[model samples]
Target: MKQTNLEMTHNHLKSIVMAIAMIICIQNANAQFANSFGKQKSGKQHPVRVYFMAYDMQYPGIAIGPEYDFLYATHQKIQCNKGTRYTDKHLYFVPQFGIVKTDVQSVAAFVNIELDFKTIYQSGFIVDLFASAGYAQIFENQPADLGASSFENSLFASHGAFFPQFGIGTGYDFRREFNTPIQVNFRVLSASVDMKEFIKPGLNLGITYNL
Candidate 1:
């Protein structure tokens, strides 16, 4: 009976040790997996990007703009619909202001989300798509007496008028120098005035610097 009791204690101790070993193995595996993907930390990472662009505004002619972006979101290791894994995803809040070459002037504050299908570390070929929405001001060459309220001017900035704007675009980033990226994007901007709709399709060429 004593031998049986001794055997029971030994078995219990062995089971405990094995359980501990299994737990350690799992923890090590998780750490290794995270390290392999460069995902040791997950959540808000702050990065700022600044860029300048020249766009051909279809209706008003050409515009030159500068933008400031604040990166506000990131998701690491997201599985795509095609069964591939994306290493990083980011969202940015951007404020842009532009001058439409003597035809018009505009300013906007907006948010845009970017999904990087091919990361810089993975490939030189970049695929980035974005959508933006926000408020904007359009000032155009108008007669001084067209004197209207801010709201009216914003909605009906004729020849030279003012209004809110929304836009969507897709662009690609290519390595330009050591750490700078050159971007070429095509976008469409739209607004309404006195029940009339105006559409402007434009192409943007810019370079971005990260800080």
Candidate 2:
């Protein structure tokens, strides 16, 4: 009876020790996670970055704009079934005013509002996605012989339309090596003047200097 009691006591003590070790390990892990998160948050000295694209081509035309970083976040140690992944993300808002000159000699003035998403990898490669909506006023210059009696026949007749665009892009970040906040991107875009109609495919290549 004494031997059985001693065995029971030893087993209970062993279980208690195992539980204590598990609790200590969990506490250490939590502390390490907190420290890592704190460091990441502290490293973000600038939350908002300003950038500009002097020449942004939209296939049918060219656009120029300034963009602002609205949100920036770092997501590290994301667990997947295979392994862990780390990345940084950014969100930007861009406002642009541009001129569109088509092959048919139609001239347009447009204003656009765009939202951009960027995901940066550790190797300085970036993937981007963006969407934009714009309104344009197109002026059709007709010959004087066409007459100004009707709207369509009038010279310098102006009409308005809306264009929405979405695209995917790839870029390289120079901030890691040059210590300058510059990024160059190339994008393939598809846009529509009227969604119910046809789609216009375009390309955009630009450089952004973040300040």
**Best by TM-score, which number?**
2
Candidate 1: how large is its RMSD? 25.2
Task: Report lDDT (CA) for all predictions.
Answer: 0.37, 0.59
Per-model TM against the reference: 0.40, 0.60
TM-score of structure candidate 1: 0.40
Model 1 lDDT per residue over 77-185, tens place: 5556766444433443333334333234443222222222222322333444444432222334333335556544433432223333445555554543334445455
User: Considering only N, C-alpha and C atoms within 3 Å, which residue pairs clash in candidate 2?
Assistant: none
User: Candidate 1: which stretches are off by over 4 Å?
Assistant: 1-72, 78-86, 101-121, 124-168, 174-195
